[model samples]
Target: MGHPNDDTDKHLRGSLTKQNKKLSRLKCSVHNYDWGIVGNNSQVARLFALNSGSDIDPYKPYAELWIGTHESGPSFVDHGNGRLESLSLKTWISDNPNLVLGERLLRSGAVLSAEKALSIQAHPDKDLAMVLHNSQSSVYRDDNHKPEMALALTEFEALLGFISVKELMDVLCSVPEIVELIGSGNAKQFLLVNEQYRDKNAKAVLQSIFSQLVLSSRNKIGAMISNIKSRLLPEMQKRKLTDKEQLVLRLESQCPADAGVIAAFLLSYVKLNHGEALYLGGNEPHAYICGEYIECMANSDNVVRAGLTSKHRDIQTLLSMLKYTQGFPEILRGVSLNPYTTRYLPPLDEFEIDLSILPQATSVVFPSVPGPSLFLFIKGKGAITAGISENDNVEEGEVLFVPAHTEIRITAESTELHLYRAGVNSRFFTIP
Candidate 1:
């Protein structure tokens, strides 16, 4: 709860009288995490340096560049009053909801720049999110579901969803130590079952096997992990390794003697080349491995971590919430609406993304839209002119907040400009 005379209300009072406030350059927040790429090797660190106009340290693990109104790490909106006054994007949106978020996006969204592997986790759906938040406020934190899309800014790797039943069975057969943990009876039962991969009931069977593997007694898990290290590390040192094997080796290093190493083999491993994208909704079990990507999601952070984390793990809650369908996760190549723009439309109405590119000296106009939007400059330098006033120079790593029904024009000043526009879309909206 906020006070009545908050800065948000004061800023809105003067701005609402104006016909168009257009675009405002935003100062986003940065999160540093242990798993992030160390030092200037991180894209996030570079961006933070650029945004802060400070020298790079080359020693910090800059992790997440969060641009949004989310309470955890909200971006700040500059009032442009030549004073030191500023307001959180969340507060600004709250005060001028109709003017900023628009009718379609009464709910807003955010963009995240991830530099490393996030915890192996899933988010609860709307109903479950509310229940969890009310009952476990300290952990659940928020009542909104997080349905997200991650578009590769660089080569990205991730483990998404469950691997096919046949695939997991094969992995188990290859790693006898892991199979031994599940006991000979259960392993034999699972392997002998002849179930079609596409059958709906197949997921249930897969979950049972996976649950057994992940929830084995601590000593059993330790023995299996030790056995895997003994057998696999030598093999890796001697010769070539398969993609899945390589992933397993990597996870083992991060979380030694943890079941997540075994669990990684039961998940589909994916690599997204630059500019490619993938959409993940609530209850889809996934883990980012390493890479730089633009992640957009509904404004919530209720993560149910399963493993491969130092944070709290709610195994039962996480397992119960998963949409256990198994297969390779689909890679979404955004639909090209034009030569200049590609639209990444995820199923959720909370957000849609567009990657817009501009050739040197060329200009493009982003037409006024029904919802608020955030524009992030990923490559090249450009000048942005909003409506009839407020021009700003934007370079790589900077973000601009675009208000509802306000058009903006971008002109490239460098070889080429690449930027991403993310926001709630009217066409994608559906009453829930």
Candidate 2:
């Protein structure tokens, strides 16, 4: 027979053990937005199905797999015993801030295999975000500014920033319907100023054209779209279309008569192959067209959308918020961190991403980071060891939360493993 105090001691010890766990498995959330890829075709669906032990429904759309403490789709800690605690990830972090060191970055994986494009939108800068959140809390969900980076998992296409003045001028000359829509006066002024000054007044000119396109009457936009299709369809059949023309046609088919079809021509068209990435700063306009990617951003959901979505459109706000910088956005191929790892560090203090590809029977040790991180295994099998915790058999689609200053080592088991680690940018903190 044991002492009566033994049970109490065991319970206390158990609670302490749970509290001292520096690495924990996380059960992430999946959003089924209409823009997501449908069924097994979606990487989001595959990951969700793998994590939840649920079968994939062929008709359902699986859009985003969220692995953060965001209020909208908060993740949960998985206790490994098939039971979940009532506290969400956000609540847990709030309750135990010391463990995570008050981290505020959000990480998510996305897939866009649908016909429709994402919204033509720009996120507010910090000051504007605070004002928008305070003035219109219902529309702008959070006060944090969102400067994001998207790392391509597959072939990805997007319209990012404004095209160069020369490219815009060429587009204007080629597409007469755009001239008709923006009015001959504005078009002529844009062409004349660019030809004379050579981009000295590019910002003002781009802003004028974009504002006119967004504010155009729906009937006028529809008529212009019809005329554009009539003119372009014959040309498309005769010869290979330019990337801009192809995008216009694609957007038209996806959301007919939307102002974004015309607005897209003013933006730089970007296509990224696997392992590539692009950074989107605040107030920069962009729209993801298709493919799978892992995205990391500051903790915010505030979007000022102009067009190409069924969601709310803040035309005036979007027009006012744009940077109106004209050029090709830079594509990133992450800097090599080690033989098995690469790091994608954007020019922001909020967040960064590290990708590791480990072959079978290989082991890699990651040094301690300044803040908490969300580590996700997107492919194959692995094992992780951190402090006293050992995930002996981590499978694909598993997410783990690593506490601040906790070093972790991963070993690929029988197959090659692909992992992405999301955390605050290392430059934000000093590593002693």
- Which candidate's TM-score is highest? 2
**C-alpha displacement of 369 in model 1, angstroms?**
1.0
Cα RMSDs, all models: 3.3, 4.5
Q: What is the C-alpha lDDT of each candidate?
A: 0.76, 0.82
Question: In lDDT terms, how accurate is model 2?
Answer: 0.82
Best by lDDT: 2
lDDT minimum window of 10 residues, candidate 1: 103-112
Residue lDDT tens for model 1, 164-247: 767877866787875676567767766676665325455766687668766776677777788877887789778888888877
Residues 141-253, candidate 2, lDDT per residue (tens digit)? 77889888999998998999999988978977898987776678877777776355757877776788789899998888999899988998899779998888888988998
TM-score of each: 0.90, 0.92
Cα deviation at 123, candidate 2, in Å, is 0.4
